[model samples]
Target chain A: MSTTGGAGSTALVTGASYGIGADIARALAARGHDLVLVARSAGPLGRLAAALETEYGITARPLTADLSTEAGLEAAAGAGLGLSFERTAWEEERRMLALNVVAPSRLVHAALPGMLGRGRGRILNVSSVAATAPVWLGTSYGASKAYALALTESLARTRRVRRSPVALTALVLGHTVSEFHERAGIPPSPPSLTLGSPYVAERAVRAILRRRPPVVCVPSVRYRVLAGLLGHLPHRIAALPPLADDFTVTSYGAPQPSYGTGEPPAGGPESAGGDGQDGVLPAEAHGQRERQP
Target chain B: MSTTGGAGSTALVTGASYGIGADIARALAARGHDLVLVARSAGPLGRLAAALETEYGITARPLTADLSTEAGLEAAAGAGLGLSFERTAWEEERRMLALNVVAPSRLVHAALPGMLGRGRGRILNVSSVAATAPVWLGTSYGASKAYALALTESLARTRRVRRSPVALTALVLGHTVSEFHERAGIPPSPPSLTLGSPYVAERAVRAILRRRPPVVCVPSVRYRVLAGLLGHLPHRIAALPPLADDFTVTSYGAPQPSYGTGEPPAGGPESAGGDGQDGVLPAEAHGQRERQP
Candidate 1:
């Protein structure tokens, strides 16, 4: 922790009411940064903001808005939230574009001038490994993430050319222990394949501080290699019967759910239907309950 | 070559008045398939329809409507044009998505059942290589292409599950000798890097006939390898100074004259502009032209 001018650093995080976004908010708050948390759920955002202020002695403001809509983005930015980078909407396909592509972009546009004037700022867009690989099941989600990565790269290039201290980093993440899977109505898998919440949070904060442009593949390096290899293989080879089946979520556990109609859990506007739980753990949990099953 | 059911086969081609779409229409017509040509410009479409009727003895119906708007798509489909997937979007990013993603999807939704009932149909979507790789300058354009590829894959997967002979192929093309460059206000580079219009048309038609999943890096084996490698590389590594330049078009040369801001070109959308006006020639001859200047 470099403390040169660290007392008043501020960060804004979107989708901060729950999941990876919430965890990232906590991690950044713990690092002595004042926080502005944005999410659609007012209840959860308020709870998390109170908790962060109590635990970290950092100023935490809870902002409720749907970052996917243009109006929502305007309200979030107009609240005078200073952030190193905005991280929100880790999942949810439709909102993924709104939150990941449009919202982050609008926020960045709002923050750029301030950061440039201050001469040193970091912007980390939390993208997923799915962005790089063609995941059949999450087509919209993956495409939005791909756009996020591309946008990050473009901004970084612009910064480099202008010799600006404003840094843009795209943290291409892997499967992490978060409420993401539960929201999607899918049980988490084994720990070896997934990451713990604390681990993901810490790594994300550190990368933001370091301004690293990383395509982070957690737990296993093999996935990174596999994602790369799969992208190159011919469409026929990549879309083999076995591979396609593996990519799709065929069953949640018997009593086969409807193919594409039913809503998910984690009740919100887009919820497919289970319970609206705050933090539902994966099916099999090991050492830490926060780890992805 | 395979005349199994050629006589009654109907192909619906969007933006078929000129360029690659027109060439594709011609190729399919030559193979004895009836055609439905769709474009915003009625004049060129009408001319092409007449020419195809005269030259190949295939019925060519000209249905002029902007495929980007919902109303436009409805009108075109309602006109009772033949069904074939010869869809391509020439310019304007948002329109590209509307035409390429929304309209075609709706059209497919309307036409798929009949094709499935007959147990035979070929749908070919013309997507540029830019779909897989991000183009810095053409952000929206690239995103739209990405959507097309994803949609194609999804449709193909769905069709497979129903055991339908409806084949959806995404032709991931590279640079080709078309008017696209001129319209884009960019000078043409070496012709070896570009395929002639006829060559692309022939290869694309052949691939569609076979119902290939997605054609990538057409005419150049090298581009296939390149696209594969780029897709796999980490964002940081991929964002290195040298590679970024190639991925983005930094500046436009000069704006070409257009008839109207929102209107499609005279004969459908003119393909990207290029220098040579000689009608489609062999790829080798085009290569010779490149070496000259």
Candidate 2:
């Protein structure tokens, strides 16, 4: 490791209460970075913070905040993680947009100048393979991820960042074993296709600490190959009905009336369902039904 | 022409007050489609509506509204158009997200179900080459367009749209002749590289009216070739210093305090700077300063 932060470096991570985010937090803490962990679940965040501080002998602060709202953006200016399922109600979709799209842009826009002034910093935005594949049709989640990936890559290419010591990397992750799927009420994926959280975290932390980290990182070798192929695949071939098990689109009944009131359905605010684990593959890879084509 | 709408098809176009959008409205009207033209500027929209009605013998309803808010989205459920420049304040970025990202998603979400029900509707989202080539570093405009492009393609691949007659096409436009640059105080581009609005509109109208239009449309032949090459260009090659005129990133002074109040800067609302013409090439292509690389 280049030890970009060395010992006293402070790192802020969002969705750090569980799954990939939690593992990443642990990895950063072990590297001797003071940590600010942000997530909506207070109990888990607090517990994680305490555990990290005790285990790694470093400062760890738990910040409870909803990253989708402006107030949340103010409270935790550089924290973000989210996902969206297919066939969600308009309410869920809106929340997804705020968290997945708006939060990342706001955080980056808010953090970059200061990072430039400090002459050193690193931003690692965890995006999904959905960013390149665009296989999920029913939701805007993939599109939101495209924004994250594009923003990170574009910023990295800019003259200011190119000339400076700051680094920006978009981790285009593959599916990982995490609470993300369980929380979304999704069935588990086959063990063969899933990745472990600890492994992903190790790759992520290593990438960010590199002397000149790449603009885009796909951790596993298999996924790196897949991402490269998907990049050049024609829209027609990609749109085709993939080999039965490769990808699929399942409808969860009719889409809820997304127009009308644009209000939350009888349910109160939809749960903040998208955790950092919503990465890689299509629906089948995520354990959804086969494509009906 | 498929004549999907035949003589009385109604097309709602946002940013119809001027530039490529206005030209598109004119083309649709000439094809005998009744028009609902939405824009923030009342004068231009009204004039265009009047002229189209008189010239094409078709109904043209002028709807003046901003498309970056829920109320705006509600007022014109299918209207969308806007752009963003680099080094802008937070307020401008917010509006860019609204118009460039939110408006298209909201409009498509609001209009899709009804279109599917009708079994005959066409959605044409105007995106820029920036959607594919993220050469622009300082603004989220390209990322926003990536959202627009991804949404259109993903939706087209969905079971519902694929099985039905509803068509969605994202026009991956290159730089075109329009008032967009002038409004943002950007200098004119090399005449050789810029395209005329009429040709682009004609191409767009034709694509939407096709029996089986493509998911993406790069209007001009040269741009089509460029978009194809760019899609496959390795990030390292792309990240390298391009041949002087190919691309450049210029800093517009220091970025404003994007985090402070998140309020309008000392100035009121930043002008809705992005129009449909913020397409193709990068900073230099758009007539900005050469990159220092």
Candidate 3:
């Protein structure tokens, strides 16, 4: 982007407390753009905003909201779009949909008109490579990402016909070094699958401001290729993608041996799918402790 | 599938009041399996159950419950699996996730144990070809189906390891003759793109019962081929799929040039994806209310 038109415009960044979202915020700030940072944690968001403001001399405002409830969505809609969900917990899954799918949509609905009215706006919806071809054991998360990508394209197409200059891009990402895996109770990503969060953010930022961005932009050249390949594969995604080694539910209700005692992985075509199924497992009951959607 | 083992076993079917679900129930009755037919409407479910029971000389039970809520899911737990959702309505979308995604997972989670202990069980999760590759404009509907497919595969994998003998299959379908489109207010499906719901059910029943049934089974041979091709294509599905023309938001909040003067389709690569600048565009929001869950 040309610094002239980019500066002074307000950008809204969700999941801005850390990782890719924070880096995107920093990249936006570097272009002299003011920002509204959104995330569940207040302290981290505030600190990130302060750091960006101090470093780039741009105003940065922080808003803490759980992007996973109707009210949170209204607050954020009035708001990356990250994804997380549980197999056993439907309520958690509901909130997961709220955060990953609904929140981005509502935010886009809320932000785009203003951007269009102002004559320039950029909406970058962060999605996953998994959307192209789902990873094993990643039901709600991958599906939700797919929803994000399709909706982004749908809106982009909707606006394109009107010759609206406003831009919408789905930032399709691969495994990045972030808190995602840790939060999901999965092991850390191996080196080969790990893409640096900063690198992903920088590329995403550039694409969003390009003269004409593709409807979907996968960050790294390698990830882009992988995305294409995954999309080509049929439903039988035999093995886990490099980034998805930890994506499967290895140990669910019980701690199963993920590695071999000569045993295949828990859900590895052997260990029986039920986590003691009876009538809505008590652990997965509605009022159970749900994940932070 | 031996007559000895299949005889007298109870079969549970959801969305059984109409379309494929009803057909599947009929097919199950033909196979001599007693039935538990579920749907949102009680009258139709009861009538279908009665008709099937009388024709096939088997017992049938009707259960009417909206499987789109926590209470509904809990009520339907230990039940059948089917999916549907809308793109624009958050309320509908939320319920879609609950029904298409939540209901299936919970049903499987509930039924799997008893199926395992009995050493003989069959779960046929009805998904769509759209899940293999999403048709444009069908956002949440497609995503929820993808979730159903992945989660089904996940649990199937989990059980395969234990030599549990319980069988799970995803019935991947194509556009079929049904009330889905009429209810959604979209025009009827074109003949070339349409498949008969009875044909779909018959095939689904065969595949689910056959030894070594595929984890994901597309009903018709042509649909199977089409499903394969869709899976092969990366995103940027060049044109709106044959099934996708009506998938776009046709009526939002106001009147737009739909038929004449040829305004490119409402979501025709522009309009920035239905941020719904105005109200009830007639092209999408309500008359466009569509589903086939």
Candidate 4:
């Protein structure tokens, strides 16, 4: 929570087995935080925690929990992120809601009181540019992020939290190099459109540690400009048929026939667990994991 | 869903036993649309349905359902609206989410395909200024509405929905004279800040029936202006302690100390179901209700 990096504070990073969450865990550990690393994959989480503990000489606990379920939520929970760029089934959408909305919400609700009482804490929620974009191709994903962004902003602006030292930030992330797209069946964006997890994580941590942390944080300059335009442009112009069509094809792959129907994808919810814009590693990343701090 | 109001088409209204929902049902009925009214109180819903049928010569079917429970959601669903302006318990917050977020989402998800397939329909979601406002006193209410607003906007802008005839509108209502405040235990706003249900309902229906319905609708001119301002203002200025304090006192009454704690209010969720911004009548309004076009 302090500007001097993690110090004696403990940082909990969910979806920490891979990608941005793992990088963030590394960043926080380097800054001297005791870590609780959470992800559905126990092996990766355990390895990440042990590596962080050894490298940073700080305590690191690995917790495996699928935050989409009630019991999972009760066990541990953020970096709650997932998105099906194409229209997915209601069940998948519900799972996305549980991860992207309910999990973070429950975590924040649970954490806020103690943070307020201590008067020294920081809660950073990883959101997406979808939260700000005027035009979105899919259902529920943007809505979920909007919930996260609004929740963080609303709580940050409240009299009690604002007066106190608790810094609440919603990192409105754009495309980052992660397994999210592959896992969700979304075609990956061009390399130019993506940011590295290391850089994004650093900026995210910095945003939360600021004197007056921003309610909405967009990591890179380009994405910040894009987010600004997307947020303010009139819907008519933003959703221009050609522009929207191009975005649809480029970002979401192709329009699936099963969109309107509530048909489950081949693997269902279990297969698509890597964090969306916020970062989570795919199962394969565990074998070839690289740890650099 | 049609520009001509009712005809042979059916419009489903949730929380229809009271306030805005009842008024809207009346408006739709007068316009000649058959109605499916959903609410928790069977008595009030039945009465409203019968009266609408008698007066408008339109089919009015009342279905009693809470919409905050799985059973309730399965039975019927909005007009999803409710808010505890003062910070309430987590249980209350969860209920608010169920009513405001889950209910509308389920309804829209259930209805969209049929509407799209038919190539004609309208879905109006009741949101609030809180969805756009930077400063909020409560935890989940504004966040929930933000989800509603984002969902509406996102879906409306999607290629399939855009090309189709279905109109999706999120009504960003301002202060209205209803039993919502009393039920939620928040003091009422000044009469000047409040708009009546009849006027609001008429405007809401008009918005949905338009050739190109707005993604977001604020009925009153003054509120439209206010919504514009609130949506754009910087957080530093918006959350200026004194300004926010005045707003908190005027809009939400005094701050409650039990905010952080998940303490159940005296009456719990059962007592407070009057729609916050979109309108729902208290139990008393049921007995002394006046039917007007």
RMSD of each: 10.5, 8.2, 10.6, 6.6
Off by over 4 Å in 1: A1-9, A67-70, A73-121, A134-140, A154-163, A177-187, A215-293, B1-5, B67-118, B132-140, B150-164, B178-180, B211-217, B220-222, B225-260, B263-293
Q: Scored by CA lDDT, what does every candidate get?
A: 0.46, 0.57, 0.50, 0.59
lDDT string, candidate 3, B1-293, tens digits: 33122667777776666555666667878888777766656676778777887899998888766665666663331111111112233443444455555566566556655565566677666566645654544344454455556655644544231245556676665666534344334454566657776776687777767655567777677887877777656545533544344233455332222212212112210011111100000000000001122
Looking at model 2, residue A110 earns an lDDT score of: 71
Provide the clashing-pair count of each candidate structure.
Answer: 15, 1, 41, 6
Question: After best superposition, candidate 4 residue B105: deviation in angstroms?
Answer: 1.1
- Poorly placed runs, candidate 3 (over 4 Å): A1-5, A75-91, A109-120, A138-140, A157-163, A178-187, A233-237, A240-293, B1-5, B75-89, B112-119, B154-164, B178-185, B233-237, B240-293
The segments of candidate 4 whose C-alpha lies over 4 angstroms from its true place after superposition are A1-6, A75-87, A178-187, A241-293, B1-6, B75-87, B182-185, B241-274, B277-293
Tens digits of per-residue lDDT for model 1, A1-293: 22222435667666566555667677777778787776666787888899989999998887676544556763221010000001111123333334444455455545544565666666666555545544443233444445555545554554232365455555555555434345444445345546555566566566546533232322246556755666666755666654442222254432222212322222211111101111110100001011110
The model with the greater lDDT, 1 or 2, is 2
How well does each candidate superpose onto the true structure, as a TM-score? 0.69, 0.82, 0.74, 0.83
Best by TM-score: 4
Supply DockQ values for each candidate: 0.12, 0.39, 0.19, 0.46
Candidate 3, A94-183: lDDT as tens digits: 544555555665566555555556556666776666566645333344555666666566556542322555666777766665353443
Best by lDDT: 4
lDDT per residue as tens, model 4, B1-293? 35334366777777676666777778878878888777666787898899999998988887766665777774233322133333344555555566666666666766676676777788777777767866444356677778878887877777777777766777776666635446445555556657886787888877676777777878899888877887788867866643232222345443343312322121111122323322211110111111111
lDDT of 2 by residue, A1-293 (tens): 12265666777777666666677778888988887777666787788899999999999887776655777763221111122222344555666577667766666767777677777788777676777865444467677778878877777777667778877788776666534334433444445546776787788777777778788878888778867777668756665555111112442233243322422121101112223222210000000000000
Best by DockQ: 4
Q: What lDDT tens digits, residue by residue, belong to model 4 across residues A1-293?
A: 35334476777777777666777778778878777777666787888788888898998888777676777873222332233233345665555566666666677767776666666777777667777865444356677778878877777777766677776777777666635456445555556657876887888777666677777778889988978888898777877753332222344443343322322121111122223432221110111111111
